[model samples]
Target: SILSIGWAQWILSDLPQDSLSLAMTHPEMDWPTAHAACPVLALAGDETLAGCVPARRRRQLRRARQAASRCGRIALLSASGSPQTFLDQLIRLHNMRWAEQGGGVLANAAVEQFHRLSLPLLDAHGLVRCWLFAIDGGTVGAYYGFHHRGRAYAYLGGFDPAYAEESPGAILIGHAIAEAIREDAREFDFLRGQEAYKYGWGAVDRWTMRRVWTRS
Candidate 1:
């Protein structure tokens, strides 16, 4: 079995000690994708990464949901970026409801590192729309929202864990909603989060039907 990335790593192993991968030089894709060849051997029978994840391992759960789908008495507001007030509100809501821990972010922010990773998803989907939330001059949070069909999907994201106390992830989603309103998108999705805050923002679980193949 050969993983393309491993081959590159092996072939290019003789470079200087501080050297990087040759794939990094490709200009067609964004930096994140250009150098994103990880080692993996997808066997002949594997169509997708077919494996069962334990339900107790919450984070590994596969999800494809419409976060802003019609399912609540949603209070809508419009903007291109999320205002500071909204970030405070989500933090307050979460704090007041201790049972709602990890429901919202209060002060997390985004930096160049976050953007580097997201640029790939954007290049992968030419139509992906992104929004950034800067707090005190540093990018505290970023939302990689996807606009498809009538709704916007908040796909991948990043935030400053240093401001985790301030719930930067909440700010990112708030910005996603604002972007959605600006584009007149049908909805703004939080993608997938089990936190109660999403429910307050009116997130619903959407199950996806996946097909598995077997080789005889």
Candidate 2:
């Protein structure tokens, strides 16, 4: 059965189930499948941000910091008091970066609407956290994600291409991980990506699977 296959491959790979039965039936339909590699940084027992990465990455982060500092004042702002005010800026900064690269999730109307409507609710529940990296009073980078069940997930982010050479994106990520550690999160999850930068933070690969069901 499709359900059994999904359970075996994703939910619980070690579980044994020889015979499975399906009580419902439906017509077959085409379904799409998606795949992603999630990178995760495990935090345990008073580990400092610098301690979580390798020596080479630490040097890179140091260089990024110096470069960002030279551009102007670099600040990491979070969505704590007035989240609404930051949401607009976050979207704008994200679009600025992705727009030049062609497009991104925010380019879709439905996805943008979902984020607008959900941000407040998630904020109220303390599940969502957003960060903006500003330079000399201008927003240049943004990080939006959720913290749940002791895990801090890096859901989405963007940085001004103008600062690409300055490495604002990498700097922001470094700050995010530091903040997560301060908040006592057990793990920092780079939700879905095989991006090389994620590995610099000492993140490990975790496979994700998608399940599709069609009745025959």
lDDT of 1: 0.41
Candidate 1 residue spans exceeding 4 A from truth: 1-126, 192-197, 212-216
Residue-level lDDT of model 1, residues 180-203, one tens digit each, is 555656545555445555554445
| Per-residue C-alpha lDDT of model 2 across residues 1-216, encoded as one tens digit per residue | 555553322222211122121222334422223346788988753434656777687788889888888999988787665676776777676788888677877877898888778888889899977888889988888888788888898888888888888877787777777778888898999977688888878899776543334433
Task: List TM-scores for all candidates, in order.
Answer: 0.40, 0.78
Clashing residue pairs for model 2: none
lDDT of each: 0.41, 0.73
How close is each model in CA RMSD to the real structure?
16.0, 6.6
**Number of backbone-clashing residue pairs for each candidate, in the order shown:** 13, 0
C-alpha displacement of 195 in model 1, angstroms? 4.7
